[model samples]
Target: MSDAVQTLTIVIPLQVKPRGGRKAMVRPGVLALERRQDVTLIKAVARAFRWRRMLESGRFATINELAAAEKINASYVSRVLRLTLLAPDIVEAILDGRQAPGLDLPRLLAGFPLAWEKQRASLSPA
Candidate 1:
């Protein structure tokens, strides 16, 4: 065979979607090996647990006190603290990056059902 130059072309299908203020390249119908962790969501959940610990330890007398110590708005602190009431499975999913794709801090802070079953139903993909 005569020597000749050969060119190869490759094509990939994907979509760019925003996740927690950052763009993510998602391949159509492909399962990702890596976890899609959302830093903002994780941080908020962690903060909520930590604040709850402080209150339980008697270090903070009230949400206002914790808010003052953290130098954030009391209402915001209270909202974040409500995360402690989340269903264990939901919290696990959030920590493991397995939460519903549309779930975010804003929707969470908006409030959820106090009942664990209702929370699962409310937060699940519709």
Candidate 2:
């Protein structure tokens, strides 16, 4: 036998389903699993709050201040403080020394005007 030729055909059907209001809005269980792998907005904010409080309380002033007091880099302290602008839960975890490693605090804070506004509004009583 020299050369051989063969032909193959495949058919696939695709179906699209229209969501029915609120039922469609509900996320599947996989979403919960995914969420567990990441830090939520609340956690970020908490971390920021804790850092801000620490700085405000004169606990850590300059880079040298943090280094002398906590034996860490001044730059690292500054970087961590920026997380206070994030959601509270994040800040809390950091303060508690259990935040997820390498979380991008600044990126998390970006475009979160509503979160900031809500916190600010709450501070001002009706």
Top TM-score model = 1
| Displacement of the residue 2 alpha carbon in candidate 1, Å | 53
Q: Global lDDT for candidate 1?
A: 0.87
Off by over 4 Å in 2: 1-48, 87-126
**Clashes in each model (backbone N, CA, C under 3 Å)?**
0, 19
Candidate 1 Cα errors over 4 Å, as ranges: 1-35
Q: What local lDDT score does residue 63 receive in model 2, on the 0 to 100 scale?
A: 53
Question: Could you tell me the TM-score of candidate 2?
Answer: 0.35
Q: For residues 52-120, what per-residue lDDT tens digits would candidate 2 score against the true structure?
A: 677688887755775567676666556555555545544454444444544445543443333756643
1-126 per-residue lDDT for model 1 (tens digits): 979989899998887867569988888653352356667999999999999999999999999999999999999999999999999999988887778888999999999999999999988545
Score every model by TM-score: 0.72, 0.35
For residue 13, give model 1's deviation from the true position in Å. Answer: 24
What's the CA error at residue 69 for candidate 1, in Å? 0.7
